[model samples]
Target chain A: MDVRFSPEQQALRDSAAQAVDRLGPHTVRDLEDTERAAKLDAAVEASGWRELRAAGEGRAPLASAVEAAIIAEEMGRGLADAPFVGATLAAELRRLVGAPPATARETVGFVADLSAPAVADRGTLPAGAVAIDARHSASALVLVPVEGGHAVAEVSLDASIPAEVDLTRPAATIAAGAGMERLGPVEQPLTADDLRRWTALGLGLTSADLVGVMRGVLSVACEYAGARRQYGVAIGSFQAVQHMLADACVAMEGSRSVALHAAWAVDALAAEEALAATAMAKAYCSRAARMVCETGIQVHGGIGNTWDCMAHVYLRRALLAIDVLGGAGANLQRVLDHNGIGGADGLR
Target chain B: MDFGDSPEEADFRRRLRDWLRDNNPGLPASSTSDAYWAGQAPWHQALYDAGFFGMSWPKDIGGQGLPSVYEVIVDAELARAGAPPRPSLGYLVVGIGHHASDDVKQRFLPGLVNGRDRWCQGFSEPDAGSDLASLRTRAELDGDEYVITGHKVWTSYSDAADWCLLLARTDPDVPKHRGLSAFAVPMRQPGIEQRPLKMINGVTREFGEVLFDGARVPAANMIGQPGEGWRLAMTVVSHEREPGELGYVARYSKVVSELGRQVKADPGKFGPEQVRDLGWAMIEAEMLRLHVSRRLSDRMDGISHGPEGSVDKLLMTAVEQAVGHAALSVGGTPHGDGDDMWLKVYLYSRAQSVMGGTSQIQRNLVASRILGLPAS
Candidate 1:
């Protein structure tokens, strides 16, 4: 399984990293209130990553998805708060559900506004148009029927908001019926195949985030161990400290391999293999991210928990990612269902 | 990169599983007193006769000389079968007698493989557990023999062991980890005392603290060079910790599967939580199996048993604790249904995370060695 990215993908990742580097260290520490959100948005525009990554030519949607994953990792490393993740999810959804309307824009959000009076707000409403704010940042609302639901909309959107912990990236909530146009009726619920695709996409992205967090945390830890001296010796020499750091490294590596293999399997169209791989990756990466972040904090001691410390940012991100997407158990159930094992009749 | 067993491995596993089914006693259907151990000796001998006992050992040394991965596959099958752990001491402490001298190999390995002898490790002491090298057990060399005198605690099955693999300090003032030697001491000899220690389960299972007062053994009994005991002990410890109940996981899976069938047949009695817990235990077992399999592949590829082994150890112990907790929760009491499958499993699972090395210690190893973090 040669899981290395294509040259184009690698170039994209490298570009993202360079763009992230422009933000400088301690930028993440500086993000506070509205300024942080604005900086993240600015960085996204500057990178052109959204357009470049989405447009890359690759037969494998999974591999193309991984290109976005790479971008996510870099964004995470920079602690860029822009909705790159949300944007990437939008792009993938567009690809999956067919191109959005030429004028459509997507932003992922929770708490979609559902109480808007059809006749009261926002210009002439097209017959049954319901203004739905999926992206808090979107200029326009995606209007679909109350009965249509969001999963099967056509005419690609510019922005789409996602709900909390939804494995398949959905958009965030916006003003109810504030800005959407009418689409056709809901065509389908997520089929098993659809769930499989959704799981890979979510898991792949989260796994990438985990790898980035781990890398960032480990780098800080190693730097701390090397620089921080006590008792006339670098604390790194002490067995107690060394073991903690070592565990984080090991977990990080395990998570990376699992994630890569899962992504690779998806690209290869090995569905059963991808299911198992993604489950193992998500489960292990979540655990690893937690382990590494905690160890990072422990290694840094009192300072690690402070607001100014970089470790705390990674720790929070790790916690959020681990809980996002319904967690390891949900993924395992997916795997169990896909593989037809471990359940009655081996089919759920 | 490949997780599936190779064709050869698959065939070997199938043969071993089939052989075990035919030769091993009936499914440990009940918590039949000693039914597990009762079948161990004969089964070990049968495996030895079939040349399947020590695939990792060199043929000249009475092993089949196959890659050690085969041993892992074999043990994995045996574990899945619910067969007793037959070579715990031999494969672990003795490592198929790899450290044993030619004479030692000739004398002890055949009997060990054939189940004519049982071996127990004597490492932990009242004062030394995690800081194992600080053990106070001393062995003073006297001409062709070494006079051993020290007290060893937490010696598993010492009372029943034909011989004890004891580590003793041969030098007084060197570093703590160094200056130690491993000896194969006969348990039946004079100057040896064994006092059974009751465990939390209330059954001794031959657990004991052994006292060696001037126990003499020829220097020939030493596994390797005089000061090589530390290395040997570490090797044995890694092996013991690395496998982490692969076979027991397999066997228990079967038992649990059977139990699930019975529960399903009488669903009126078991609730969703009980069923869910059982399902979780099964999933936990699979996770443990995958981790161990990866480690086994790494080991066979000559990768050092590094901090990753500690991860396995931690997971194993945690799963064991979780399984035990689930069993106890389901059974509604400690040691419920004296012969209840849940209770026995729960009781035994407690030992998994504690032995080899405590889960906390393994975590420490991971933090320092794998993550390269600063110690607190």
Candidate 2:
């Protein structure tokens, strides 16, 4: 079977790369440039990439999950401090239950350690709920108990507090018992199958972003190795440095390959199969990203700990990406559940 | 991009599955046993007879003249059916077909591919294991033949081999990398000695050390130019090193699933941590499968195999060890269970990191050749 990207996918990737290069942050200071951040947000909005999963003919997605993942990866590579992942997940939720798109910007709310979608009972959210990457959003979607299963609802966003660990994105908390209004009803309610498919999409995107993080950090480390010389030789000439970079490169490629396969499986396989693939991809990427990112920092020597170097930027973005949907441990647990280990029904 | 078999490929796969089921050979479980080693040749011949072996070679070489994907299907199905792993003689095929003259191919390939003439590699000597360029095997040209004198170790299947696709230094004055030549020497000829070594797993007849004293070879057997030996050896090594070429993903997948079955059979026997370790092993296996699928896709798109195979080798070692460790902690005892064979797998897994090429050498190759890092 052919795994090479089609010409159209290649064209999309090229355009995404071009956009990131133009509007992406170049220095650590660029993260503080509100003017550049606004422009980046506008460019992403104008591109309509966030709505790629919006309903189309026959209630299908406008584009494939692979296309959405391509955009996410490019955003991650540039460390573009924009509102893509949140806005995109918000669109995915609307499309899942056949709800019309909200007039204002929106993202999905998360509960339970900020890993899964927040669930509301009778249009009321529990305390400690937060909306991730809700920088410019006006509302956030939360799931509500329905007749057959669940339905989508939205609660207004006041403002985002600065996220502590991950500097790239902003997170906002919803007060306990915050009111959420149900979206206008359609013929179908969301089922467990629907949520599983949505989780697959979320996991696939995060895995892609983690792959991008590895790629970006490894590039930074390699350049540093080639330039930073000691005792009249580039550090890259040292076997110790070369081997570290090489190991990172290998792990990064493995993550990319598995992530691509998971993205493809979203449209090609059944919902359960897609979820399993995404969980495995997420596990692989999550485990590799931290070690690979550390290798980048290690190669940079002392400057890596300071705010000036870009290695911290990559690592920060990666930690957030790793936590989205699930980290390495959570994803491995998902795999175990899917395989029926420790499950009530026992083996398949 | 798609990763499923085409209609024709699906059909070939179905046929092979049926064949394996109908012609299953019940061999002894212990690979160290004489009965098991005796069973290997017959299995190889049966696969050849059924057109499941060498499906990728040209028609003139007694192959089906199919794409390499067919061979991949055969490998996967063999693993799925609990048969022996696919024979790894693609190296020998690559060494002879790519560098040898037409007459050489016509003389050796037909028999080699069909299991009529078994061959082993005589490349790694005592001092040349990882640093193959430093080999001291010598071959001096006479009127119509070359007289070879050298010692080669770690030659797999040398005892059963009808010929040894040997590498020797034909010009000592030139640089080591430039002075070498390859020969398809007769294994049973005079001045040749084969001493099969017992591996740590207690497997005999699978590997050997050979000594040569003026072993004569026809001058026509010299493959390519005098200095092309290094290139040919690299080519040969890459064939087996690639996960795509060897279908290593399918082999690992089979083992991982088997381990899963064992854990499921008696979940109480394993701790939660052990089960999670099994899950980790499962994902690692899947990672290799995905990586190999992408590499195969690249190969189908006409990208040639090269130094990147070192990446595949490294990943394979990691995955295999992960699976082996899972097997040991979850199901294996100090002594292996006959039905499960967990400890046997664990022991063999350690050998993989060192065989064919050591993991250190693979990283060195990747660093220097792929990453443009300076070599010491």
Candidate 3:
């Protein structure tokens, strides 16, 4: 019944936190714009993070979920241009698709076909199968081969990468070569359990980052409020400022808890359990982060809105996080679908 | 992490279901009003007399003393049986039976458990809903008694309540939150007035407002130390909401299944995404139920309810609201019994996020307490 992070897990989170702190958000931002899509190989190789990616194949999915969460949080906090999309997501997918060759590095794709390709069997092929565009050289078109392609894995564009505000981790449109040809039929679409695991991993990382961003925003707001005077007294002394800061504090904590719970669920429970918790975490924390950080900018008033102000960084990151991993609405729909609740009125 | 209830719980649920099926005095369908508060007091008392109410309260306090989860079980059964809700604030908020002082507990608890008296909370005011500490309702000491004067709003069933577990400010200047006290004031006492407050469903008055123009009550009526009103109120507020998305999930599942049938019956009645929406909500229900059950279990084992409660509140509210809207969408013109149910749920569901705590407050709780983030 009790849920507390194991000392080892706590250590893992702390380590990630420390690393991000040392690297700092500015350094990460710098790296993002300069390196963009090319940073993935270098980032993975330099941080010894490649080992973490490799470990997922042999480790428990829960353990991988936890580690991913920790790393994501750190990266999010630092706003680091690390390849979370390629490394974390690809790692999990590889595990689900079963172990791949050591030389293989997996990346997912979503094809948008304006013209519905005439298939030999419309009844047999799954609805959402589009071609995989190559952002990375190693990227490939993935098919879970179900009902002989009549029904298949639900796929969408992985926006966490190239669409990232930080250009370093920009999602590259990779070309699919031999990997594109290796398609198989999926008997079961990505299960609720699998989505839960991936989602837990996504939420944990995102929440941690959101918390970090909020912390940065709050620090800046507090400083300005203390130094900025109104009616000859520090603005920080004002009740309005205090209340705003307090609210931000609350939001930051909420995001943190969601991330922690999501991580814990992924590690301790089945994938479906993890998915639900993660979805809750993602939905709540993202909205909270936006509110808290926006307030941070508001408290700073004119100063916070400047391009140079770090508050905007937090704001941008929050926006990116919401869309990166499918957004709150999408995850919620996933939850509903998994439970066998269909028809327009069923959810009500 | 294990969200499923124990086998014993399953068996107990089954027994409860079977018993209700055999013995439930089913209410006439037309009699089930939105403000359906119409059971005989003695009939309500009979359950506690037979040891059915307060299953988790201490045995010394006239309960079965089972695990807290059993209370959830009992609530589920009661709702399923469509039995009238027993007057609860007296037992749930005030101590059941002899838990309060011998005289106080004995006088009020038995009456409440046995349904002779109904209780309503007297906490919120004009300025205090989510920000409850700002309430200006005052009660000054008058020798061995306290004279209370203030207005209370959003008191559920206050008009019908025989007693109120009320909070009043005893000192105005010390601090905004401190110097407040809680008293169990008899609603029928002098200088007390109650008026009904309409809910979204205009047909029902499930709540009311109470005004006290110098209402006086004995000093012994206080629940705890004089200045401990904040703590007492805090404890009670946290307990007001809990897990049971299972019922909502079940209800939503029924909606989705029925929709599939309806749509299949009439192709033009539902859109394509409408069917998906129902399915998605059902999936989410299962997911939310699992997470919420795990959280409840964690809390029952003495762990902090943590930010997980906020997460559950947020998800549950979204599901309830979404399901409500979905039902309305599918029901088309909002007519007939289905539309009526849809409208009632849609209106009530709005409170899911705001009632226990606002979604905004929940987000703040998560951000500050759980994450090591600075207060923004």
Candidate 4:
């Protein structure tokens, strides 16, 4: 099977990179530029990237999962501080349940611990439910249990919630019993398979983000290694620093390869198979991203620890992405359970 | 990008699975016994006879001239069915295929493809394990023959190989890397000696040492021009470390699967930490599978990976060692019927980082060559 992107896909990736580079933060202080953030949010909406999964006339996704993941990764690499994952996942949910796409930007609400989606009750959202990547979004998507399956629901996203660890994208927990509304005239109810496919996309997108974060941070670290000198030579000249950066590069490459496969699987393989692939990618990317980000900080030595350095921004973004769908530990368990690892009958 | 098989690949894979289901010779677990080694020879021949081997080699060399993905399918299916491993002599195939003369290729490749000409490599010496350019293996020109004299350690298939693709110093005055040349020496010739060496896991036939007072080969048997041995060695060495060349991902998958089976059969036998370790190892194995798939895909897309193969090598070592440790941790006490296999795996996994090139060497190559870090 071919894993290399087609020319169109490459063009999409390049375009996404250019957009992020043009509008994303250049320094931690840039996060305070509310006008720039609004511009980026508007630019992202205008790009129609948030609706990549919106149903076309044929009732299929406008673009494949790989394209959406490419946007997520580029956003992550440039620390684009905009709502992509949540918006894209919200669109995927709507497509799966045959609901009309959101008129405005939409994000998703995850339970407080961020293990799974928050299930909304009759016209109400739960307390301590986190809405991810919802800075400029009007509403966050939730699940409403209906006859035989779940129906698509939306709850208002409170943009005024307290700030979180990730300075780029905003993750806010809603108040208890917040008002909600279910999307209507449902052509199809969301089944277990539908949810599985959505979760696979979520996992794949987050994994791609982690790959981007690792690559971005490693690039910063390598540049620093070449410029920062100690003992009359660049610190990169030392095998210790070079080896550390090299290890980070390897981990990032490994994370990238698996993440790409996971993204491809979301559209190409069966739901169960795709879920397995995404779970593996999530585990690998989560672990490697954390290590690579730490290596980035380590390579910078003292400055890496300060708020001024960009390495921490990558680390912060990576932590949120790693834990968004499932982190190393959670995804590992999902894979094990999927494989029936501790079952009475296994390996058949 | 797609990960699914084409129709032809799917059909071939299905037939290969059917063949394996009917004819799988499930040999004994890893052992030092000649019986274990003997079993592999027939298995290799059976696979080649069924046209499952040499799928990526040129057609003139008895291959199907198909892309490498077909071979990957064979590898994965073989591991899935618990069948014997395909003979992992891709380094030799690459060395001879890329460098040997036309006559040499026509003479040796066909036999090599179907397992008629069993071969081993004589590259590593006791003093030249990682610093291979420093090898003192001498091949002096004597009439129309080169008399080779050297000692090689950790030589695979030493006891049974009919031919040995070896490296020796041909010009002592030149630079170490340039003075060396490659030779295809007959293993049964006079002044050649083989001594089997037992591994930590008790596998003897898999490794051995070779001593040569003067193993003679015709001057025409040199694989390439004299003093090009280092380049050829680099090619073979890089191929040796590649995961696809040895079908290592499939083996890792099998290891992870068996471990999962063990935990399932007796869930209470493992603690939470041990189970976590097993899960992590499974993820690592899956990562390598995905990584190798991408590499194969790149190959299919006419993309050649150079020093980036080092990245795969480091990842391979990590996966191997992680699986080994996980298997040992899960298989408590190592006293059950197949527990020794876990111990063997753990021991052998240590060699993955050390063999081909030490993980340290791999990191060095990646740092200096790929990352462009200054040498210090």
Candidate 5:
């Protein structure tokens, strides 16, 4: 068995990394700048990264979930203020619903109840209006409950976009009101397997993003420790700092391994196994990434707490990523549910 | 990348499984008893006759010349079948088989492979457990023999072993690590005395202390050149620490399954916390299996064992302890009475962190070696 990527996959990853590298180091200023976010989105679109999950003529898909995850991780490491995850998920949902391809400059936002479905705040406009990154999106693929299953509602995001904790990616609440166009209750009503597959894809990409954030933050922290001196020696020379960084490294590496496996499972394993793996990856990465980012800030000393440094940006992205799809507890509960430990009677 | 076995590997696994099913040796009544060794010898002989022993060693030295993955498969399958814990002569095989002279290999390796001899390692001293280089055991050469006078503790199977891989300082004036040497000493000598050290789990004579009052070993018995003991010992220890080699995942899988059965048997007795702990233990065990699989893949691709092995070691310790703790909590107070099996296991699991290397030392290794952090 081999764990290393093939040459073609490696090449794809390298090109993706190179494209995101052009964005340069993410700064506090980039967070609020809509122009920079738009620029980053355009660059990613030009790289054909947003179309990674799209199906082509008779081929299974142009790229596998593993490939999509690789690009997601790169975007995360760069902290690029692009709607990469949203756009990718939107393409996937659109494909599942047999919708036409999105226009060149038009980004597609995605919003669904990643956990259990409930009534979509009935009084709210467009009914269940969930917030998603829609800074540059013309519309969103919003999941709304139909009779038997969820349906994709193409809702306009022009009226409801708002700021989020993850400043790099703007969010907006979408509802099926007058301006929105309703899609299927698809030709085949969305099955539980379909929802699970979607959840697995979402978890894979989110966990990859978390893995990238932790690695990026840890690298910055280690460099800072090496350069920053207090008692006539690098702080990294001190045991406390060394141990902190070491623990972060271990956590990040473990998270990356699990995330990559989950991403591969999305395309390779049976539906149930894939769901379980996705839950496990999301649960582990959610906790690991937060710990690493927190330790990253700690390793940077006083400067880490400031708005100017990139440490808090990584932490913020990590915090935002954990909330996406679900937090650690939610995913862990999913793990237990999928592992047959749910319900009052054990071994359901 | 693929995680499942290749067709050849699958076939090999199937064949080994069938062999094990047919020639299954039931569990020994007692590990420290002479009857246990008597039963084990034939088992080892059958494995050797089947060409399973030394599958990863070179063909020139009577091995099958397969990749290390084959050996790993054997280990995994053995654990999967719930086979009795076979006597492990791998340390001696690796030490003498890899580094010893051709003469030494011909003399000892065949007996080891054929189960005619059992071997134990003598590296730790009472005062030098973690700080092994500080061991004061000394060996003085006179004529063609080295007279060893030292104390070795935590020597497993010392009573049953026919020989030992012992480490002693040959040049005291030199640096601690540089002055040591390794030798293959016969265990039946009158100069050597073994005193059983009862373990915390109340397992009597599971391991022991070997007192050497000038135990003599031939000069040619040295595995490597004099003062090369440190390097040799490190090689063996690294092998011991190697991920995926020990089949811990398979063993833990059984323990976890049994725990699940117990929980299922008495569902009303457990709380949410206990169930959650059990869930975490299972997750950790699965993660350990995955980690080991990835490491095996890496090894097959010619990656040398490195600090990443410490990652598996740390996880093993964590999973073992977690499962043990869950057993105790689920079994309730006075854990020893109703579930004495789990109680013994829990007691033994405490040594997981201490053996091989402490979790703290492993973290330091990861820091300095893998992360390139400054040593503290």
Candidate 6:
């Protein structure tokens, strides 16, 4: 068995990294700047990053989960204020159930599960929200539970929703009586297998994002440790600081390894196997990403605690990311349930 | 990028699995027992006769000379079948086979391959556990022989070994690292004494300490030139840490599956926290498995071992300890005879962090060597 990426894939990843680098660092001010968000969205779409999973002349939809993960990781590393994750998930759903394509320039948001579908059925919907890059999203593709499986629904998010802890990606809570359009499953409805595949893709991509976040934060902390000297030597020369940064590196690499495996499995393995692998990847990466970010802050000393530093940016994003599909406990429960060791009570 | 076995590897694995099924020797009562060693001797011989022993060794040294992947398959299959571990002498043979003189290789490789001779390492002394270069073992050349005198502790299987890869100080005036030398000394001498050191488990005598008042060995038994012990010892330690030889992934997979079986057999025995802990252990084991597999793949692709081996070693310790803890937590209170297995595993797992370089040393290695952090 081999685990090294091909030279071509490496080249693709390098280009993605370059694109994210060109966007510059994401700060708190940029989170609230609509003009900067629009510019970033235009740049992302112009780079064809949004269409990575869309089918072309000779390619299938989402040709390589590994390539998609590479792009997602770069976006996460740059902390780009764009809806790439949701857009890609929407593209995947369209490919799976034959839904209409999203507009060329319009960003799409995604929700894997709709917690309060009853609010949607009622004429007046409460402020129902899901965490996505909703600042510029035109519509949201959400999965609602049906009798046997799940159905896809598109909801317009023209109504405003306040930002959450992760200011970069705002939660667009839908207002009452907003336009809601049901899509997909019109011909062949999604089955249990489709839901499993969707969950696998979601977990794989999210884990990749966590890997990127951890790596980015760790890189920053390591650089700071080397340059921020005290007592006539770099603090990195001290075992206390060196050990913390080293642990962060290990956690990031471990998350990357498992996330890459899960991403590959999403495309290569069967439904059950892919789901199990994704569960494992998410379970490990969720906690690892948090530890890496927390340690990154600690390594930076007092300056790391300030909002201006990028450490909080990474930590905030990681905290929000881990809760997107589920937390570590929930994913771990999925693993146990898949293994037939426990009931599926905690799995969403 | 792929984790599945190739066609040839798949076939080899299938054949090995069949052979094991037909000739399965269940787990021995105790690894330190004479019967266990007696059983392992023939088992290793059978493996050698079947062309599975020296798959990665050079052809000039009476080996199959195959790629390292075949050896990995053999190891994986052995673990999957719960077969006895390979003889400890095999490790020394691999090291000496590669770095020793032609005379040394010819004299030792055959006996080691056939299980006629058992070997143990004498690198760690009571005062030189982690700082092996500071070992006080002395070997002075007198005429055509070298007289060795020192004490070695935590030497596994020394009681059953016929020979030892001993390290000693040859030049006291030089630096700690440069003055050392390595030798292949016969263990059946009057000056050498081995006393079994019972481990924390209270039932195993697999480890012991060896004392040498004044043991004599021919000068020709030196594996390399004088003052080359440090380099040779590094080689031996690297070989010890190499992936795929121990089939650790398959072994961990077995442990995790057994834990899952126990949990499933009685779901009410554990609380939600314990169940979650069990699931986390399974994930950790899988992560360790994948990490090691990636290392093995890199080796097959011609990438040599580096600081990444330390990463795998650290993960190995973590997963082993996690699994042991989970098993104990789920087993709850032990009822005398029924909980012996869990108690033994829990006690043994404590050593995972201590043995083969402590977890602290591993972190230091990764920090300085792999991460490029300045040494502290």
Best model number under TM-score = 4
Candidate ordering by DockQ (highest first): 4, 2, 6, 5, 1, 3
Which parts of model 1 are misplaced by more than 4 Å? A1-191, A197-201, A211-215, A218-307, A328-348, B27-33, B48-57, B62-86, B89-117, B173-176, B244-280, B334-340, B373-376
Judged by DockQ relative to the true structure, which candidate is superior, 3 or 5?
5
lDDT of each: 0.61, 0.83, 0.57, 0.85, 0.74, 0.73
Regions more than 4 Å wrong, model 6: A26-43, A56-59, A105-127, A144-148, A159-163, A184-187, A344-348, B28-40, B51-94, B109-116, B242-245, B333-337
lDDT of 1 by residue, A108-201 (tens): 3211222121221233343433223233345332323332233433222333443332211233323444444433333343345544564566
TM-scores for every predicted model:
0.71, 0.95, 0.66, 0.96, 0.89, 0.91
Instruction: Report the lDDT of model 2 for residue A197.
Output: 91
Off by over 4 Å in 2: A175-177, A343-348, B26-37, B64-72, B335-340, B374-376
> On residues B57-158, what C-alpha lDDT tens digit does candidate 2 reach at each position?
788998788766566577668767867656667778877888988988999988988888888899999999888999999999899999999999999888
| DockQ, computed on Cα atoms, for candidate 3 | 0.09
lDDT of 6 by residue, B110-166 (tens): 777666677778989999988999999999999999999999998877887898989
Q: Comparing candidate 3 with candidate 6, which one achieves the higher TM-score?
A: 6
Q: Chain B TM-score per candidate, please.
A: 0.88, 0.93, 0.82, 0.96, 0.90, 0.91
Q: How does candidate 3 score on lDDT?
A: 0.57
Residue A290 in model 6: lDDT: 88
lDDT tens digits by residue: candidate 2, A1-348:
667789998998888888877888878888889999888888888889989988898889899999999988888887878888888888888888999876898898988477788898655676677888888887899898888988888887767878675677888776445567888865577899898899999999989888887888887788788788898888988878888888888898889989999989887888998999999999999999999999999999999888899999889888988888888888888888888774543222
User: Residue by residue across A6-67, what tens digits does model 5's lDDT show?
Assistant: 88889988887876677635678766666666666677778888888775765345788999
The best candidate by lDDT is 4
